[model samples]
Target: MLKYKLVSRANPRKRNEKQFYAQLTGVQTIKRCDFLSLLEKRSSMSSADVKSFLDALEFELMHRLANGISIRLGDLGSFRATIRSVGAVNKKDYDQRKYIKGVNVRFRPSAKWMREKSKTGELISFETVGKA
Candidate 1:
């Protein structure tokens, strides 16, 4: 279950009006070690082995992304790297060195994953806990 509280704040861009939204009462964080322990029981590999495997996977993912490649993760999703650049006046003036502004990574989930997540029969609930 997800618990949240309604929060009211003055609209910075608008005058004499307040904006309301639901904010999470608390957040739970899961760490690498905790995840490794859970994975260890589900796999034949030990925690240390799982940790090493995850490290290698992350390294390879970053390496491939840096080389302008997209990697597919079967049913989970795929990761892609993209860059945004400033506009140039002409084709002759368009140079990556001067026009490139930022680089970012994007993930797209698979259709199966999205379909399963959209099913209302799944055991998921949201609770409102008043104001924050």
Candidate 2:
């Protein structure tokens, strides 16, 4: 049986406006160690111990990513730099649109994850679908 739940926050704009919003919900597991139990033998450790270790590891990762360094987790993924816009753009200067100040963050994922995903199915052409 799956012990953990997948949780997420709703997009504020979608609330109470659509039927799908009711269906869309986030279910996060109680803690990371709860997930760790699935991959390894954890009979010796308590949940609190596992949680503390995982939390420390996550903090270290965020620290490294903030310094423009990528953290590679085996069989998971790699975290790399990404840019985001900060300030508002002036409508008159179209040429300046490409230049925007932003921050850096790391992304993590490994090839094994991709391989597992590929076995699910092949992509279908959008045109093949009939209109409702």
Candidate 3:
């Protein structure tokens, strides 16, 4: 479930007019240990083994993304690196190393995550919990 609140802001051009929008409220967070425990129960692996695997996975993902490679985790999803840059007048004058203003990580969810699982008992259910 998601929680949201109605927020109001004054227009920059017309300060007399106020605009309203929905803002996400407090969201619950889960810890890495929780995932480790879940993996241990779902698979034949121990919590320590799952933790080690996860640690290695994190390191490898960072290493691969730094090298300009996107990773596809099959049913999970894919992760890639992106950059925000200031524009240049000409392509020949553009410098990637200097023009890249910021770097960001992008995650694209898999098909299962992007849609309902049909009759496979895979479905998403959510309810709003009012405001924060």
Point to the candidate with the largest TM-score.
1
Count of steric clashes across candidates, in order: 0, 16, 0
Candidate 3 C-alpha lDDT tens digits along 79-98: 99998999899999999888
Model 2 Cα displacement at 54 (Å)? 1.6
Task: Write candidate 2's Cα lDDT for 1-132 as tens digits.
Answer: 212323344557886443221122233556455586642364566666666777788898878877778888887789876767655467566443565566666564577766664444332111212221
TM-score-wise, the better of 1 and 2 is 1
lDDT of 1 by residue, 1-132 (tens): 778998988888895799988788766889988988999999999888999999999999999999999999998899999999989989998889999998999999888767775356354457899756
User: What 10-residue stretch in candidate 1 is worst by lDDT?
Assistant: 117-126
As for lDDT, the candidate ahead, 1 or 2, is: 1
Task: Put the candidates in TM-score order, highest first.
Answer: 1, 3, 2
TM-score of each: 0.71, 0.46, 0.70
Against the true structure, candidate 2 has what lDDT? 0.57
Worst 10-residue stretch by lDDT in candidate 2?
Answer: 123-132
Q: TM-score: which is higher, 1 or 3? A: 1
**Once model 1 is optimally superposed onto the true structure by TM-score, how far is the C-alpha of residue 66 displaced, in angstroms?**
1.1
Q: Which has the better lDDT: candidate 2, or candidate 3? A: 3
